[model samples]
Target chain A: MSQSLDTRSSPGATPGEGPDATRQASPAWRRLARLALRQREVSIFLAGVLLVLYFQFSNSAFLSTDNLANLVQFSATTAIIAAGEVFVLVSGELDLSVGMVYALTPFVMFFAAGAGLPVGLAVIVGLLAAGAVGLVNGVVTTVLGLPAFVTTLGTLFLVNGLTLTISGGFPVQPTASGTFTSLFGASPLAELGWAVLLALVLQFVLNKTRWGLHTIGTGGNPVGAAEVGIKVRLIKTGNFVLCAALGGFAGVLDAFRIGSIDPLAGGNDIMFAAMAAAVIGGTLLTGGSGTVIGALLGAAVLGILKDGFTLLGVSAYTFDMILGAAILVTMAINVRLSIWRDQGEG
Target chain B: MADASTGRELLRAEHIAKNYGQVTALTDINLRIDRGEVLGLLGDNGAGKSTLMKIFTGFVKPSSGQLHFDGKPVELSSVSHARSLGIEAVYQDLALINELNVYRNMFLQREPVKGRFLGILDDKKMRAAAIEQLDRMGVRIPSVDVPVAKLSGGQRQGIAVARSVYQKARLLLLDEPTAAMGAKESALILDVIQRLKDEGEMGIIIIAHNYAQIFDVCDRVNLVEGGRIVFDKKTSETSVEELTDMVVREYREARRSVQAG
Candidate 1:
């Protein structure tokens, strides 16, 4: 880094003046490449890729087309949920109710479908129920001036209780509607469900929209955002709504993919893993800086790691411990890197 | 026509008073700012300078008295109301989002949208306008895309100034704009204030503790003690030594009164 800086600052470095000028002109591209390489998401992605390569060399079944497809299929739900978590995390807030909301969504759909409602409308209604819960959580946090963690925690338990009561502690197996089940549960096309499509669209919106910019700004500096007339409250509210809506959609996808709606379908472990993926991907808990792509990459890394560990004959309990430790170590490294970067710039 | 001859007072605060429960923050404060003049508000710490400025910027409401804008009595309910009437403030912190690039920060609240349908932020136009405004003020930043956090302190201040001016602020209130700045940056800011004065169409109220700065940039200086205007004099008619004496005298008298009570 020091060498590059020195070269950029050397004499006769003016654009179009000398050989150094050519290098100076390419600084923007070089800087972009450096940024991509330095991104925490990229590092996690490389780790996932390396893990996959190692597993494939060790076990022939690991690289089989069927296993690879199954891996992607398994990761799809986690990726969708983590994508939603990214918005909440970036806005300097958290949603603990997401796991409960995820569990409740499938129940809502199954009941709606049983009550003579069409599969599509039932799914929509289920999503709306999740969104409504999210809205309640957001209003509770913002209007009541409660900490998001506390507010969402209350909602988490409330939703979980409601789901258990509705299901009567029993799993419901809906007669899979041919079109709906095929769209979200089948082989090749299942990979392209509403959850995955929504994730892609959300990633785009988070990067390319005015709303995204304001969310980042509000998280980074709410006071500054308010002073500049960015309407921090509105931005935060929108982020909450987006997160809830996505979490609800992920819940619907889970119902279709799993072919059954269980009371404990989306347990605490799913929420924990989603959050871990987001943090490991580079979304700081303190907020202000993060990317949706980073969350997806983090999800991919975790999924690959889990799959690779299983292939390598690692015990399930040991794998869980290792995953938890890896998340902690990655988070610590991220913080150290951020501090070093800030100090170097200063 | 008569109002035009009188230059139509832009801002007037009459008998303004503020209190925080049992504590009196300001008392019987009366002031007026006219178009194209710099009103230097000078006060020591705890002298209600910040209180008055907050009321002016609609950050706080006075417990008593009325604020009038453009010769009409009005209540500024929020900062947006103040901004809509061309009142812009540059607080001590500058209130700029440091993570954003210069163009985005400058037009944060008022970004120009482009295209006919599905309009997106007109980055090209905003960048051009930002560069033009900064260049006009002799501010030279390396790139408009650089986040403000990476910029120098002086450069950040310059961006704040540029933002206020770009918004076509008619009444600019700068609260200790030079307090934390070095001599050169402060001088640059002072030059910008002077240039705004030369434009002769906007009113400026600068709050500063430094007598030298007030003297250098202000047309008239209003000295406040105990939330009341103890002295208001033309900068040309007053000496720095006399202003210092008045401030010291005001402080001592307040202290003596407290001691007596």
Candidate 2:
């Protein structure tokens, strides 16, 4: 252990300088750099790079501007959802209703638009409907002290039932009006503009705000955070609400992208995909540590794999099996990298 | 040893009692901690050491008791209330997020922010402050940027100690700070405790099962048994053997009573 500590020490100390003196005099900058790279994220990032290169090699189409644009567009939808899931995960909670919430958002927007509601009002109402579901989820979880998984699972069914009951179990199509379609799902900039913008904003909030710190703290150690005067319950409740809103927003984006709202827009498969993206990006299911950028990268990796496989004419049925395998492998690699990093530090 | 005559008492607990459902967890516990003194709370598992500390830190409201902080009667209704009054508890778990680096963990919930509205976390200021705080505590690590999950148990504990000190915690409650540490690492932690004592009149309540450690750094030792204080004596006035005997005797008596019932 002493030998390892010595090896890990900063390079400025003279060769014969005593260990105690070396420890006492080491510079702070060197230490900070060491801390930044000594985690699973760095390793996962490297793996993501390797995957990108391998896919690019296998298919000449992989690196084309058009494919890259499509890849970003595809990832934008899932990345937005995952960004919110990051909050829920960081608060040591989960929202299984996100998938159902995603399915219900478009219907709310469609009905609002059909009622002659202004686009802005319709958007607000749609967001509010999602926020309300999130609020209920948060209240039930925090006030009643129920585990987030069970509460959100119940909400999943509840939201799904509501969507079915409202839509009469049928798909809802928007008027295809230029303004309505453009705001909801139009790609005027020739890419997923709103989706990308939302992802970036969420990323900024996660990385730069007080809410981000509290979310991380709540997930990392609830008891410790509480002792430090952090309102763990409040942070967690806020995360659930935020996550629901994001999921709902993603649903709106999806509806606009497709120009229609299916009763099963984002079914269980998308939830699995989002989870895979998050976990593969280094967000542990156990919570306390995650990054929006990592999730975005993870989503990109998945998007590339799926798109590439489909472009190569791989069967859709086989894609599921491939995705399942990919998720398992990525998660296994992430776990191993974390363990290795931990061992290296000690 | 310095004279105990100068500093004022910072915390006092009177007839503190707590019950969990039907079972009594702690009973009639009385203790006093003066500024700049380290008081060791010693007991084996299930000896109500944790319960006493919990009550002091407001994790569990005492069914009945009076807790006085800074000579004022205070009701610690929540952990935040206790912390706002300069009380901070460092549990054995260290409660650090493995994914966050030292500065982030140190300033976790109470991050220093800049600006009027949507004040951003002052990362530069926080990082500098975390370095200063840990350095003052005599803790040397590779970096503050690495996630704490990568740190050794000793390093992690050091971060926790640094956090409490950074918060200007007047009364620090450490629950087995060095329980799983090696001899060298444990000694390093003891050095931190000594530094804290000299730097400020920060009263500390250290809960530990290790008698040697407790005896080495503590000014006084309080032995708890069967949810009550069985012996409270100055460390210099008491021998380790006597302390061991008191613990063993309490254990046997408690076991006998349980068997008899």
Give lDDT: candidate 1, residue B105: 86
Please give, for residues A1-346, the per-residue lDDT of candidate 2 as tens digits.
5643453333323234533443454445335324534443554455556667777788888888778767766677787788788888878998888888889887898899888998667877888899889898998998999998899989999999999999999897766567666666556343367655766776667778788877887888887777666888888888888888888888877787677789977966666677777777778788787877777777777887787887778998998898887777666545543443444445
Go through the candidates in order and give each one's C-alpha lDDT. 0.78, 0.79
DockQ for each numbered candidate: 0.47, 0.46
lDDT of 2: 0.79
| Model 2 spans > 4 angstroms off | A1-73, A176-180, A188-191, B1-7, B20-22, B63-65, B115-119, B251-261
By DockQ, the best candidate is 1
Point out where model 1 deviates above 4 Å. Answer: A1-40, A192-196, B1-5, B114-119, B254-261
Error of 2 at A228 (Å): 2.5
Identify the CAPRI category of the predicted complex in candidate 1.
acceptable
Inter-residue clash pairs, candidate 2 = A31-B142, A31-B143, A35-B145, A35-B146, A185-A256
